[model samples]
Target: MPALVRAGTAQQWPQALAVPGGVARLSLGPAAERPVVHAGDIPVLVLGDAIEWTAIVGIPLAAPVGEAEVTVQAAPTAPARRVAYRVAAKQYREQRLTVAPRTVDLAPEDLARHERERAHQQHVMATFSTPLPEGLQMRQPVPGRRSSSFGLRRVFNGQARNPHSGMDIAAATGTPVAAPLAGRVIDVGDYFFNGGTVWLDHGGGLLSMYCHLSRMDCQVGDVLRTGDAFCRVGATGRVTGPHLHWGVMLNRTMVDPALFLPA
Candidate 1:
């Protein structure tokens, strides 16, 4: 996908595009609001409640079938963002998505085997060799090194579980967590597994999540500036350490963080 909303004007709002590609880029003019779809004609889905200035959109692509008109709009978001997207689904059609969730608990030897398989999954995610979203700025939501690597085959004691969904950055208890980009804070909760959490809506189909927080600073519908504090890092939920489990949902699929960050 193209990046930075065309790179003109003073400010930009996040443009959402739901087409093919892991990262969708748009150049909405600085302070530009209600940007329209610019990708000529194609097939894409614009999610609601996600369009705003200076946002990141996570897109999921359906296997393209011949010709289709891609529609983009904003209304309600299941963390939706939409604008424009690049056309690449025509050539990349083999989507044998491997979903091995371990299915059950296992003995130590079996767990080791699972870990090996899980490592292979991570290799697959990194196999695409795609570049990061152009014009993206990598600012830490909270200062810390990585506590958990992406796609680590996590075993609780001796039982294997699903690979880690998001990247975990090590931080201290009560460390303030900020919005990495501008967006509306839409969801906040203390779920059974995520501990304290806050979901930020970047305009046009991109949504970000910060989990295992000690506190939530913004309520739903609260607009936040990039780097604005939304919560604090904590060891809540199911955790082996205190860290921020930061995740970006591009059209619902959880891609790698390195897909957006500088290499």
Candidate 2:
């Protein structure tokens, strides 16, 4: 297959939902070449060819519920233009959970370790590689009940924390976790918060993450086809039970993973 799939229509993979923690698919008009688009400072994924191009931008959950824009440069020498879009507000329900006190209130050494791991993971999320020919639509990485939804305001042990950023699937510890889309393994590590994490680069600033695995079967630089098993669900991270935490990221922003899945 070709490295880049030509997006010949306005309707592309990943349904567009322009709310915070959602996606905005903007048309870049017909260009002789693919236009370069950036949501704020980070580059976004631009698909299509010389005919019609579209910019798929991932809006942060913390984004203001109002106007937003992306910079579009039609060509190398062309002047950049701002394409505006609206980001509607979204209200996510609050979730209260009780976990180990140590996990919530980390020790000094654990805090430092988490900080280092967070930095490395941020770098991994910024990866942008060649576009995938297999396209952007994805399959669920694991088979189970949806135990948690994205963007939930989580209160851990009565202490407020960041909103949940991924979808959690309730599954057995040894149940296999597969690749949602064709991708190259970009990062894998056992961390303080996410333990047994794996990040996959789907190219063009699009990536997917799987966390809390009992086992990781792939390493960095390993390429996997859609549906290929790469890990197993587990309760390796800070959690009350075994599950698969799956996240989809675009342009360095973590978006709702359900946007890439079909109903």
lDDT top scorer: 2
Over 51-107, each residue of candidate 2 has an lDDT whose tens digit, in order, gives: 888788899999998888889899899999888888888999999999989999999
* True lDDT of residue 197, candidate 2: 93
Model 2 misplacement above 4 A:
1-11
* Candidate 1 local distance difference test against the native: 0.54
Q: Per-residue alpha-carbon lDDT of model 1 for 1-263, expressed as tens digits? A: 33333332223223233234344444333322332342233222222233443334444334353222223433233233443434344233111122223324446776675577546433322221122233344466888897675555566545655556577899899999877777777667775456687877664445577888988978977988887887889988667678899876654445445454533
For residue 108, give model 1's deviation from the true position in Å: 26
Error of 1 at 51 (Å): 22
lDDT of 2: 0.88
Measured with C-alpha atoms, the lDDT of residue 130 in candidate 2 is: 88
